[model samples]
Target: MKQNLLLFSIGIWLFSCQPGAETGSTQISEESIKTHIEVLSSDDFQGRKPFTEGEIKTVNYLVDRFKQYGLEPGNGDSYIQEVPLVELTAMPSETMTIEGNGQKVELKVLEDFVAYTEKVVEKTSLNSSELVFAGYGVVAPEYNWNDYEGLDVKGKTVVVLVNDPGFASGDSTFFKGETMTYYGRWTYKYEEAARQGAAGCLIIHETVPAGYGWSVVRNSWSGASLYLDQTGGSYQPDVLGWITRDAAIKIFEASKVDMKNYAVKSRSEDFNALSLGLSASVTVSNEINRDKSQNVIAKIAGSEAPEEYVIYSAHWDHLGIGQEIDGDSIYNGAHDNASGIATMLGIAEAIANMEKPKRTVVFLAVTAEEQGLLGSKHYAQNPVYRPAKSVANINMDGITAWGPMKDLTVVGYGQSELEDIAEDIAKGQGRYIIPDPEPGKGYFFRSDHFQFAKVGIPALYASGGYEHMTKGVDYVDSLNKVYLTSQYHRPQDEYNPETWTFDGMKLDGELLMEVGMRVANSAEWPTWKEGSEFKSIRENSMK
Candidate 1:
């Protein structure tokens, strides 16, 4: 009863404090948000995975809701944008052999290492491919750092570190310090290795620098993976994988090199790729399936400048079914993203009733985010609206379900002026905007907003604050820790309307709605901050 009373009080407070209250244009519905999350996260939705019956149901449901809310189809004549994806499911041999100097070592699949092939071939093999230690596998002209300098790694395996030099050295002068530039991402490492003409790329995973455990790598890479189907094959390594730190240590020891000393030396610009005198052999059989996924898009055209757009995006895909735990196989990603979709729905409904702004507003529910932001990447590459005309992208990945808070946390806080607008609106709600507490984890780069950001559009991604209304900071922190360890990416992430609160999620939806409105109405474009790497990209794009 106490919790119920608190929720009622929050609703009343929000109703009184809403910026649109005086004008009576639109009011957010917390119950509607709760209902959307409940249905989307329910068992019947089959976890809302793409390329299955779940995707059919999910997209149809979104289109129905958008029509009910009177939102026009965002695309020319349809609410769905077809995204062509190729699914690669690698069936590796039980064991992989590493041999060098007349000595052989066998690594168990999914236990010591996890690997897959980007090539869409039935059989992919590596026979005694020489292994070289390429530090971080980065070649950035801006940073003047080249890990593959003077090294020819064609038809060989390049062992790379997970993150960049700045993360290891803790120096502000190198690669954005601990903030994790795009160079630090594992995707970047694989791409760079492929560009260097390497046949295989293996990232050495440490929990601290990788920001995730070995279990994540194992589970995520073990199952069927989706990628945008390339017409004539792209520059991707034949084998991309992650080796546990223990496995890497053993490999280094066998190669007669100290892993710790090499890691330290790799942080410096003068470091060169080391020949490990090792060779790797493996064969992977893949079951390849090609399919078309849809990105649900709905729009409210502008009253005046309808060509200019403000995009609101949230991914609608999750890990469908994989290894089971506690007799449950479904990974019902309620908090991971169902909440985010719910927030999007709430924003869409609210905006539908509001006075049409001068610029267009788009609500996009993208697919295949759980498989490395593929949906957003496709949209960024082939947007329905020209990238230059899109004003900004506001992404909501995982909104808080733990009730109201006194502040909001903005991911990628200082990268764009959109955050300034978010902060101003947050202040109007008696809340302040705070930077992400764990910047080292690189939450900003891990979401859909990053796709838009890469294409020179100012994007904003944020979540509810940690300072809870009823419960204090300590409780909120503990709750977050519990969620991260116990529920994140697991089957336990289900919606429980009896216990879960939508107050915080509703607040975040309101903030996003207000930000979208302000951006849509404004004449000026939001640009990246002065020192941001994306600033020049945005300027060039505008030109």
Candidate 2:
């Protein structure tokens, strides 16, 4: 009864939300978003990394809030879903040796190169595997493009570019132009290499094309990584790694191959693999720790139709602590995901106080997203609810940390019908919708929503755009550049009550809240758009 009174008071406190969607209630407040960010990003939480005491604090906080908001447990009277994961800390030798053509080049680990293997083995090695430049390492039959058309890469180490040819060619008709498909992602490159029976794969990391600096590569791969337990079967290559652009250039020079000339040729349809005639050798030993992480789930059961559901998600993990900079060793991830989780929490608090919808609404705080979407992948494969009953997914990765924005940027624009719904609501708030300016980053595929989309659930991952209301576009761009270069994946992501603002995050929260609420109330389901690669998957699931 006391909790009911508090919930009633909460409903009374939050009045007059956005228009056209039950404007009488459920306000997502900036103060609310701020508090969550501050608490989660504080040093006390210890970066919220999985498999740590920090996880306990984070999970308990979420559960307490859910109970206070009067939400029901999503998974059979339990709020926690145990996701099995294996943490592997790969320790490679100090030097990666490349020898051929009377030339020997040694690349230092974490400086000129970084390597790790996902295979569940005590030790793995590349014993002088022949090096092959396999272009972008893409095999898209739909586009008549195959970088490994003729040559065999079995037992060889294939060196590939970062993004696909679309970014290089700038031809809209060819491979979706500057926008990156699944083909451009580093994950795809590694996966394709393993499929071709390659012993190792090393991606040439270019700052611009790869969308982040080499520091990001160094920071992310320099630590223990979490993968779904691979006890059943595994196809991961023995050696998966990255080489600095300078390192790649040196190797090219040693191989007598013109790096510039080959880079240009790789963008064309007729491009083929080039045997650099060089051989690479590196050995990596793994320290594997297998455990389970929790996915916090709570739901507001639908009053009318409880069978159908609408899902909202945010990742709850980040780089815990490493590579101290500026006298800070803690990676707080304030804007990276604390803002996202805060916004989602705000939405949850709002909706929990409101009347239930026609479809069950689930709030999922997934774990280990920083480790290549592993938590969400486990959820997709081992789902609590069937994909067929899932209406749509509204995802918040990193919400706006600044003040209000005039535009909301859809990461994968035109991929799903969710963008259309969001655009209409955004316009009502005097805000516009735009596509992601930096499509080469593959931001869409980087988030947890991509896992849902993989299983044919239409997902939306939109956030604050480059156009801020008070600040201009250039100001937003400059701020983003600084964050990407310095703070991203670094220990400087702590929350600052003095500088960081949450008005834009509040706006985004309210916008997506309405989207989820509307979908929950309606019987109709949103879907993938035409030309989207996931369209057929959704169609098959629906059928």
Candidate 1 regions with alpha-carbon error over 4 angstroms: 1-25, 99-105, 254-260, 321-330
Residue 9: error of model 1 in Å?
36
- For each candidate, how many residue pairs have backbone atoms clashing (under 3 Å)? 0, 0
- All candidates: TM-score: 0.89, 0.87
In model 1, what are the clashing residue pairs, if there are any? Answer: none
Cand. 1 TM to true fold: 0.89
Name model 2 segments beyond 4 Å from true. 1-24, 97-108, 150-152, 249-260, 274-279, 303-305, 321-328, 474-492
Best by lDDT: 2
Residue pairs whose backbone atoms clash in candidate 2: none
